[model samples]
Target: MLLAMALTLWSSIFLIIKVGYCYVNLSRKKGTVASQSSTHEGAFLASRSIDGNKGQTYRECSHTALGHSIAWFQVDLGGEYSLESVKIYYRNDANWCPYRFRQFYLDVSNGSAGSTTTLTSQRKRCYKDNTTALATPPSVIDISCKETARYVIVETTYNAQEAIYLNLSGPVLEICEIEVYGCSVGRYGESCSRCHGCSTCDIISGACQCGVSFFGPNCSNACSVYCKGNLCNNVTGSCTNGCEIGYYKDKCKWTCNPGCKNGCNRNSGSCDNGCIDGKYGIECYDVCSVGCISNCERMTGTCMCKKGWQGEKCRECSPTFYGPSCEEECSPHCYNGTCYVNNGSCIDGCTRDYTGDKCTQGLYETSPEDHGTAIGAAVGASIFVVIAVVVGVVTLRLRRKRDDSSKAQKDERKESRIKYEKETTYVNRQDHSLPGKDHSLPDSHVHLGKRPANLKTQEIGLYEIMDSGNGENKTYENDVIAKTVAPVTNTSNDASEENGNVYLVINESQLNSSHYDELHVQN
Candidate 1:
């Protein structure tokens, strides 16, 4: 029971204050002790040597054969564990203790093959009695056990100096109780149940503290199932870092197919880089039928066939074309050897008695009888087109004339006047003589005052013009108008220019700059 109390106290450091739970003593029930030699009931009965009396007897401990240089006391802990630490209490804890080795060391073993070298901390001397033999090996000694093992031992050596100091006595190993702590990794609870994840769980409660690349209640499940190369969070189970290529979703549950553009979800897989184009559903998986212009959609599987092809599958002849491969072969009576694929309506039109799909149905025999009707129709259509064009042109000219008349009324006064220097010569000479005078102005051929009625049909000329002054005839550097010209009259007080309604010449150098500023308005 000394071992039980030790385990209860040790476990309290790890669980009790928070959980009020205790651990079991690994060396109590099934454990037994053995030594290098036997005494009384042998080392096996020494397993109960908690204090001094409970063991077989006083000197009946695990004593070595006399003259032997070394002795050992080993205890089987029954089951393998990630041995945390061990505490070996001395057998005789009374006033004058017996069976204290000069010095000793502890070791452990894990394998079931019973190999001896499975121990560590070789010969760790405890309470060396070199200067003077120890009164009694430490009542309690602590040993750090970083190894995994199911057996523990207390072994010692007897040297000459220590033997002589003890009056030439041989070595003997004894133990009261051996206390071991800690359970194996991944195993926890009172019965040491295994957890679900790669973690160390609460030994008493069977709770898990997961480690790298693991998840679930006991940290035994792999998180890479959906995450591919990544490890999901132990608690959240999300591949927060990222997912593998060709796999997508919150948990990377969906796989990307080649039909998807750049393998992404565009408009629920409709268009763009995120979309996978096709008929969208069942028809999308199947190949388009032969003679199809475009693939079938959904369940119809029909297509927009090519020019020569027809029907839902686009395999038969079209309305205008005939024969296999839709070669348009009209009857000889059908002009241009072309007819409608649907009813054989000739491209150049059908003959008199021939009328049907491909022109196969006809009155009498289709013997070139339809050519006369075909030629007459084509000529009639051409004649109608010519007449329509002539009518269109005449109508357009009349509309233009009406528009021009209105504009003339609005702009007849847009012209101004310039007085001639002297009697000037004019061309396209009409008499233009005034009724009140024998001659027109100073020159006979020159028309003035009242203007010529049809200036568009007449040509006239002027040598030079000048400002309102009796000055010599002077020419301007610029040739303002070279074509037909007509004499004009102006009675306005302000200086004005006389010009054809179609031509207006402005002299920027002559007009005051301010005039331009005021003139810049919307036309």
Candidate 2:
């Protein structure tokens, strides 16, 4: 008996706690009630339904016109709220309309409260009455409509097919009171707890339904800063939308590889499309080798080497290798096995007995046949030298013979000049012997008969000699031609008594003064 009493006391305490929870009657005088055409506009207005009265009298209930094809009654909760349940009290006074509210449905809408058209169009049906045929409809009904809305509506429609059993031409809806129980928006549960950083919550559990910028159980956490639209998964806190530029990963917490173009993969940070210039590898983080002709392969970083470069990364020249692809071997003659990578030339000069730029020539490897060829060339060169010497000697002898002949002719002319001088002296002495030559002429005094002082005696002699050999009728004129000098005066006229013969007579003094000592007679 004591245990039963204790159990009863505990139950009593639990009931008091349940009643203490914070839900309110959202449709009781807290909202504006409305309906389709009223039966009597002033007497049975829609406002009577939510007047905070549970009275079943005609003046306390809301009534619709009798002939309404589809009748509707609704309440505006003034603001959005989470609808938990709806308790409706139907008209029971005088049994005037027992079956009127039988075939009805309850719905909630989040549409515009200013126009009932939006409320009807966007309504979500919550409950429908399924009463038996000819059965008495209940005076009061309770419906669980766990929905978030601003408008709570009840609708009833007439069906011609069911008119035979329902005995109704159309639907006429009347209600004594409507008690909607729920919490305000963003709050939920019997306690009406607030849901932080969210739009709404579950009515029974108070679990938050996060907004675009929030995540986590209570929607208290913000999305990652790199998330595209601040949208993320509520449970995991990962970005649901993509990340911003240069960012990646599920939560958009990691940055893209620096060498990537556009961006990188969200899962692995790999550059999918391609890498930037000179970059390689999946993440585009590795650089191409310096010796690469262009960029390396995206996955391997293998370089297409430039000239004289080799290996996977083109980082080094192979041992004893040089030139294109490093395929050509260095010269064996190179000292210390070292050579230029580009041309395989010796870098430290040649080994012993080797010569030339690449150190490939041998110093003492001549054959007997080569020696014989060298001897033959020497013999031929000697013969050519001897021939040249002999020809030069013969040419020198001919030149000396011509010079001696010219000297002999000059000596003969000199002897003839001496002889002419002696003859002239004799003639001059004979002249002195002539009678009546009292005045003795000076030894230096020489005369040509009336000749101009400008006339050269040697030139006159040459002209006379040349003219005699040619047998050309050339006369001594005052004008000298380019080839010879002439007598300035007419010597032939002076000697006209000698029968038109031209004569150059030289006295002893003339022979001494004149360069030409020979006497000439020209006819």
Candidate 3:
């Protein structure tokens, strides 16, 4: 029954199995082809694609209609296969290059529009050999698609019967055989058992190519517990981006000591920033005072002892050490060399010469060392207080000096101003004999007490007068102009109105029809 079914396929090849389509299917499943074939309606039926028939005779071939530019034949493989490659065999009965299939595409789908996918070539050989005439038959095309699908479609173009376009009778699509090669069912290779999702497995040997984290024969073994998320290199079991936080060692087998911030260096186990909980020193070996408010420095464990406590380990100061820092000694008057650390009170009896608890009086003789220490402390405190006061006074004085300097600089940069006085200076009409000399223009604008050569006269406009008042018409950087202001009674001769350099701000109404013409002078 399998051989009979294979013979009826007529036109194309079937699955690239060892035998016929019957063997490829193992169980018969229906297929459909859509086209207008001149020979037989079902001649290019989809069943032929997997029939394993390579016969090239027209009577034994499968051909699609030449009326349309595109046609397709799809096959339901009954079950999804992780297809490896597609092998297509064209009719070999005669030279059919003119009607030979030229342009086409292959597509696959999971029976839904959203999942429809077009198969692409994995190698350069998937392209057509257009350099030479495709006159011969037995032409086969092989393509690969590492995808899973139950429906395989071959869409080809008929060239719209344009023979000369491709130097042939017309582009046509005909098939004689097809073969599909890939893993079988849910298993792969000769072992017949699944190699799982590992694509690196050696199918023949059932040995795994082993990706990160997995190891052993089939790459089935998970990474060691030390590995983060059980992930590591297959062979070395070493993490790639370094060990996860708090974990260390080559295999991340070791963990950081308790109370670590950013864990420790992989090999050295030293705290990255520093140890917490008052541990100190390079490797955190040195211990700080128990009374310390915070941890000590890393390099040295010298306790920044508490307020009341003194000493390296923050131990309470002894009677002999009595003072704020507990480095000073008690009075020599104290019997048995005993005195309170907080105060100078004698713990035992006082010396024969001493009478009070502190032995402040009497004829008691004191030790030179004790006396010198007391004198030195008093002197040191006095010197420190003097230095602090001096520093404060100097700081205040320097601040005041800075303020004074800033104010002086601002004063120097300010614009100078001079009040205008009524002047009788006027243009010397053609006859330069009698000059209007009273209250003349300031001498500043004259060169060596002489009238400037560039001086001229013209009617001054309102805007021009305003410009003069603003000092805009002044040509010199230090030039001053009257701002239409009255002169002050206290105006000193030392005002910036030195030299004959100044602008007049006469009223426009006063400037009416007078013989006095305005100066059109360019400074």
Question: Which candidate number maximizes TM-score?
Answer: 2
1 or 3: which has the higher lDDT?
3
Backbone-clash count (model 1): 16
Per-residue alpha-carbon lDDT of model 1 for 1-523, expressed as tens digits?
9999999778656654464333444554454333343443344344444332333234534444445556666666666654455666654644435434445666666532234532333322222333244454455666655444666666666543544566756666555456655566666654556755445654545545455567667676666664756677665556655556555665665665555445444213222343243433321344444557665554555778877677776767754567655755446767666676655567776667766544556777544678788788999999999998997788678757855774565333222111121123121123343333354332222222333334443332222332223356544322322234433333334424453222112222222111111111011
Tens digits of lDDT, candidate 3, 1-523: 9888777565335332333322133213344332222323555554554564566556555666554534555555656655555667766555444245555555655552123433433211223333223433236777664445665566554353445565544345566666655444444453346665565444234345476677766567766676667676654566645677787887777887755666778778777767776677555655676656467666666566665456566756655557766666777878887788878788996888777778656765556558998899999999999998997788678767965875575433221211111132432213312133334332222111222334342222322232233556743221122223222121334434332323334433333322222333332
In the order shown, the candidates' Cα RMSDs to the true structure are: 29.5, 21.4, 38.4
Residue-level lDDT tens digits of model 2 in 163-265: 4355545677778888888988888877788865567877777767677777677788888989988888765678887888789988899999889989888
TM-score for each of the candidates: 0.29, 0.36, 0.31
Runs in model 1 deviating more than 4 A are 1-21, 31-44, 49-61, 93-99, 111-114, 118-137, 159-168, 188-196, 199-523
Local error of candidate 1 at residue 99 (angstroms): 7.4
Model 3 misplaced regions, further than 4 Å: 1-43, 67-69, 103-138, 142-147, 157-172, 190-523
Give each model's whole-structure lDDT.
Answer: 0.49, 0.68, 0.52
- Between candidates 1 and 3, name the one with more favorable TM-score: 3
RMSD of 1: 29.5
Q: What is the lDDT of residue 452 in candidate 1?
A: 38
